[model samples]
Target: MLSVSVWPCAQADSKAQRKGRYLPEYMAHPGKMLPAIAEHAITHYTQPGDLVVDPMAGIGTTLVEAVHADRMALGVEYEPRWADLARRNVEHATDRGAPGYAVVVQGDARDIVRLVGSDTVGKAALVLTSPPYEDSLHRHVRCGHGSSLTHRNPDESFIRFREILEGCYLLLKPGGHLAMTSRPKQCGGKFCDLPSRAWQSAIDAGFELLGRYVALLSEVRDDDLVNAADVPAHLPRHEEVHILTKPANSEVVAQRVTRIAA
Candidate 1:
């Protein structure tokens, strides 16, 4: 029952005021979703004691929030450095006597079922994450061990997005939800609708789009618009989180089982 209705423009708090403040080692970055946003999504989609997952759990934002919200958490990080930080953060959150447990597995999210085990398939209540934004970031930053880099090609990025969604679809129980954070991007003088692309991929991967929430990173100002001929003209300072769900029917479950097995 956490209501996000009050945050039409999204809350603006200094990075120091957020949950990430507890762990200064993992500074807030463009690739990571805000812990506040993740907490809101988790509470809205799942009740206490449910199992929540973040396949691309950078620095354990979703995992820590899930644990604090009294839901069991599972995170998978491809970068070894981030995986290590996530593991430590999870431990830190759990040691505080949070109601639920958290664990991070290091591996490609596309191979999640294999890494986490087939037993978790159809058992998770929610899968939430903010996937890589193709080549959005200009330069890579060192995340403790090494620089964090993602696929730069849009074509490869979309393909990887679909693969991750397909894996997440299998991880959810019938009626379980999948929520992802995405923002529109400017590509070669054209605006790419990543949220829509992800939605189509999720549908093809057997998920139904349920809702969309926009989280503002900063207040957009009219003066911020420069002499640029972009589609939106002024870049949106907000990112979107798309909520999706598996059909709550035995037939859909059967189809998912058949699809995953094959």
Candidate 2:
């Protein structure tokens, strides 16, 4: 396994690059996964022609990155709006000559096993996704007009999240990896440590923890880190990427595969 602790993947041109790859309307998505983060996980955890899935795919960032890296991609999105956009994004990637194929299913991620079908069970090489943050994070403001945000019960949301994680466990190959990115945020003026909660959820879902890495959302300048999350003041400078695997003697199998490939 790759042992890097921090991933300095936020490039200067990240915004422009993302705008160019995705549809204009996708910019409104509340929690879109960074392309760099998706790319890094796909490159390290999967191989060409391998299957990569994103259970809570928002705008298909993982799917787009995976297909561009020559890996088949599958995504399950809860919102029909985002699912349509995700499907269009995959089509856009295909039109741009991405070699690998991709499909986006519109459904709840907790039903991922059924949504993806029995044929796909235990076939995915990697499951990369980022769970949604609190309701406050999803608020959209435009020209001094803010969209109405629905308050979510944290406990209920966490329970659904754990169910989704369990579904992801069933979708992976015996030695497949699950990579998730999340960060802490303020909920009702109180700090909510979602990453820690997600880590526990993965473990409860029968996955063996492998690594915990940081993917920086900021840039280094003049020997100092430039904090990009300035608006909320409490937003984290980096998101935690937790890597876990299905507990099917996966460690030994992964090491053996590494040796064979080497």
Candidate 3:
């Protein structure tokens, strides 16, 4: 088991960066749970020196956590402020007693394959990301002056979302693991349908469903927060974390064989 203690921070390296905590774009943020998530993946699917990638790298919480745990982390953020903030947080984390490698880029995750180099991105052993929802959840109120809602059409959300996932797919080494945090249940006046779409997207993007659980924050109560403003009475304010993996080893091998034969 590779614990966070193995990678103690080294203050000697001068390459520093961060994204300050000036913006609060999304309230349903997964800021602190990242360390546990990264630690979980490291214990189960990776080693002490593997790589972790987060496409939406919101506040850089995930990257900081990965670096503290002694794993290299790569992040892509469409928002410059967020990306810069993430870089700063990562740098400060390593500057502390946490040891590991971290890198953040400001760009669309759809271009990850090109930005990080095709072969390099496709060779990671684990990818952990908290992607944006399909709907324009934050259009009503823009916090921190963050630029999230791309002017794309309805399906464009899913298209780019899947593109980001598939980009991770190509970067994930065989047998590698992928864990994504998503809110699959949205408040739809009379009907709710967040999980089905999420499931469909995951399957279509070449990820094998592994496991999922409610992300119950031990310190905070989300039920009260999400249900604010007299929202749906029946809606349960809970987020489901989908644990998925790169297609199994055998499947990847068979595909390679078929391609070679062709």
Query: TM-score for model 2?
Result: 0.85
Can you write out model 1's per-residue Cα lDDT over 1-262, one digit (the tens) per residue?
Answer: 2223322233444253344434677754446566667887889889999999888887888898899899998898888888998888888887887778888999888888898888898889999976556435212222222222255455666677678878888889899999877777665567777788877778878898877777654533463422212113255655687888989998977877687668
Question: How much lDDT does candidate 1 score?
Answer: 0.73
Model 3 lDDT per residue over 124-201, tens place: 878776545433222221222234533343255667777777777777887787776554333323233445556556
What C-alpha lDDT do the candidate models reach, one value each?
0.73, 0.77, 0.59
Q: List the residue pairs that clash in candidate 1.
A: none
> How many pairs of residues collide in each model?
0, 0, 15
Better of 1 and 3 by TM-score: 1
Which portions of model 3 show Cα errors greater than 4 Å?
1-35, 134-154, 185-192, 219-237, 250-262
lDDT of 2 by residue, 1-262 (tens): 6455988766553565576677787777767677888999999999999999998887899999998999999999877888999999988988989999999999878778779997887799999986557433322222121221113455667777877887777678997999988877666567778788887888777777899999877777887878654324455567789998976776754553343224
Q: What TM-score does prediction 1 earn? A: 0.82
Which of 1 and 3 is ahead in lDDT? 1
**lDDT value for candidate 3?**
0.59
